[model samples]
Target: MAISTIGFDADDTLWQNETFFRLTEQRFAELLSEHGEHQVISARLLEAERRNLAFYGYGVKGFTLSMIETAVEVTNGQVSASVIGEILSFGRQMLQNPVEALPHAEETLAALSGRYNIVLITKGDLFDQERKLAQSGLGAYFNAVEIVSDKSADTYARIFSRHGDGPERAVMVGNSLKSDVVPAIRAGSWGVYVPHELTWVLEHEDAPEGDPRFRRIESLAELPALIAQMT
Candidate 1:
């Protein structure tokens, strides 16, 4: 089957995302610097994030909770109430930040929208994702928008089915090889990785080697020509 539908990931793929979280983590480390060093705070936070992932899912809310947990543990309950408040403030700042599109994101979407049934399948807080989409001004390009809790093989398979594409007939394009590319390929779709310069540590994974359906490009500006060649 010829490729007819294309799914794009929202964060880091279409616009800037992880940078905000990265910046907020810096403030968190500073707030609790008395308790632990930067590396220690960061490691503790990552551990807390992993433990709370299933319960809190993803987004600023989960991150905020994880930061608080890390602060308390690192300080052994010596972390002040004022410091906790500051950590929460960092999360709020991130959520309130304006959506900024990556280089050529709008152009890439514009080029593809007319040619394929474009879909946005992103995982994060539903309300936060919706806010970002509305603010992005690129939402109009997509025929469908899905704000999912997780992006797994089943999720891609189901999404592709709805958009009327199978593994051989659909493409998933995003920044993370783990969340965006690998699962889509496992479900029989072409996977395109447009690597972001900075990504969250947890989202990193190795690309599938010797996978005929997988492609990697350095920029969104190159995507139109790539799609033209693929289809």
Candidate 2:
């Protein structure tokens, strides 16, 4: 239970990310409302996003492409240029939106920074992730920032090795049981799921309900005490 390093997932775990994505998506649906109902628009958009993930990875840019693709299909290729323009506008607005730190994100990081080698291991377009990290102002608390295209057990192994941290001496915290917790647990590190309300459906996975290496907390505020108990 001796954990020397703690890795955090940046998006939902550290700050308000999924909320923006959800907001943008709703606005996107509105733009294509004539083409389909809310449910259909959402489903089609998610389908586009899933397919695009492999090619574009994750980020505002990829999202913009998916929205364009969805709009074409939803509107049966008759979607006007104005609507396409509006969709691009939405993406730009999202990219420019100010990053808002989630509750206790900074305070908890400040508390952990001195005690552990803190790292931000998040998956997204590298530049966008870096931009958000820079905007967060909590970047100073982390020893390193790893903007990865994917999060897997092997990624964790490499990160731990690069930092001279062993799995037994490290832990991960994030909202996704799929991307953050499960992978870390499989890598022999402890993982904590700090659930965020607006998770993308694509990020959803059955929770690690009874995994011994996995833990769930109500908020980042509980992290320090949880780490203490684990130690």
Candidate 3:
């Protein structure tokens, strides 16, 4: 079947997201300089994020809690209230950060909007994801919006079935091979990898070699052409 729907990931795929997280992490390291080296701090924070995913899920709120948890762990519970306050401020700053569309993001959406059913299929804190979409000014281009808790084969199957023709007729586009590409492909959708400069470590996964449904593009600019070729 021809591809009837195009699913776009919101964060680093369409606009700047992981970049803010990177900046906040640098600030986190600076705030905890006395406790440990940046590398140690970052590793501990990542460990906390991985462990806490089931509890806190993904987004700045969870990241803030992870940083605070790491600070308390590294300091043996000696982390001061002032430092905790700074970490909270970092989270708030991240929440309020301006949304900047990545190069060709808007143009790609515009080019494909009418021809295909454009769905924003992203996973994250619901409010944060909605805020980014509204601020991005690209919401109008989407035929449907899905702010999911996580991306999985089941998730894609359900979403594409509801919003478009089905996973068999949908293409999932995003930066994360783990969350965006692999699961979507497993669900019977085309997985398009558009790697971002800064991806969260947990999201890293080797591409599905020899998978005919899997495609790759340097940026969103190449997406329209690729879709045309596929059709």
Candidate 4:
């Protein structure tokens, strides 16, 4: 099948995102561990995030707030104000830093630009996404860039419908299984999972084995040739 449109995931899929989060998380873990075990703190933080999602939605700001909230709860309100400030500062830093594109990200997007209607379908803070895109320089290759609040089946459905590309003729390429592959397949689109070396645990999952519409690749560099074979 000739792909009418190709959608790409932003964060760790195209560039270095989780590394900053990971560094901040180590600090969070260290602070939280002062109150309890690492596992206990991690579980409580995850639960807090789940509960707050309805109110806070998604992104680093919400995540930073959740960390502070969890710290207070875990420490019985004895958590230091300095720790809270550090977390908030880290979130801001994540937004301000220059985005580093993944290996071959620019080259591959440039390669695929004219062959298909390229789109960036990513979820994050609006300002952060825009800043990253602007820094990436690959933004010029994409016909459209969408910064979604979430990437559910409904989100994919609306995006494909809006682009006038049906699922069978569309393919989603990203590193996240949660936000990229699973939802794309559920929306009737083909999914191409390109595993990044450092995947966020929240986004990691077992690959879909023996699924014709779902394909896995070692890296983004091989995508153009792979797409050629697929068609």
- Tens-digit lDDT track for model 3 on 1-231? 899999999899999999999999999998998989999999999999999999998999999999999999999999999999999999999999999999999899999989999999888798999999999999999999998888899999999999989999999999999999999999999999999999999999999979999999998999999999988
Stretches of candidate 1 above 4 Å error?
none
What Cα-based lDDT does every candidate model obtain? 0.91, 0.90, 0.94, 0.84
Candidate 3: TM-score? 0.99
- Regions more than 4 Å wrong, model 3: none
Measured against the true structure, the TM-scores of the candidates, in listed sequence, are: 0.98, 0.97, 0.99, 0.93
The reply for model 4, stretches above 4 Å from the true place, is none
**Top of the candidates by lDDT:** 3
Worst 10 residues of 1 by lDDT: 160-169
Q: How close is candidate 2 to the true structure, as a TM-score?
A: 0.97
Output the better candidate (1/2) by lDDT.
Answer: 1
Please provide, for model 2 over 1-231, each residue's C-alpha lDDT reduced to its tens digit, 9 standing for 90 to 100.
Answer: 578999999998988888888888899888777778888998998999999999999989999999999999977889899999999999889888898999999999999988999999999888788888999899899998888999999998889768747777889999998899999889889999999988888888988888888899999999999999888
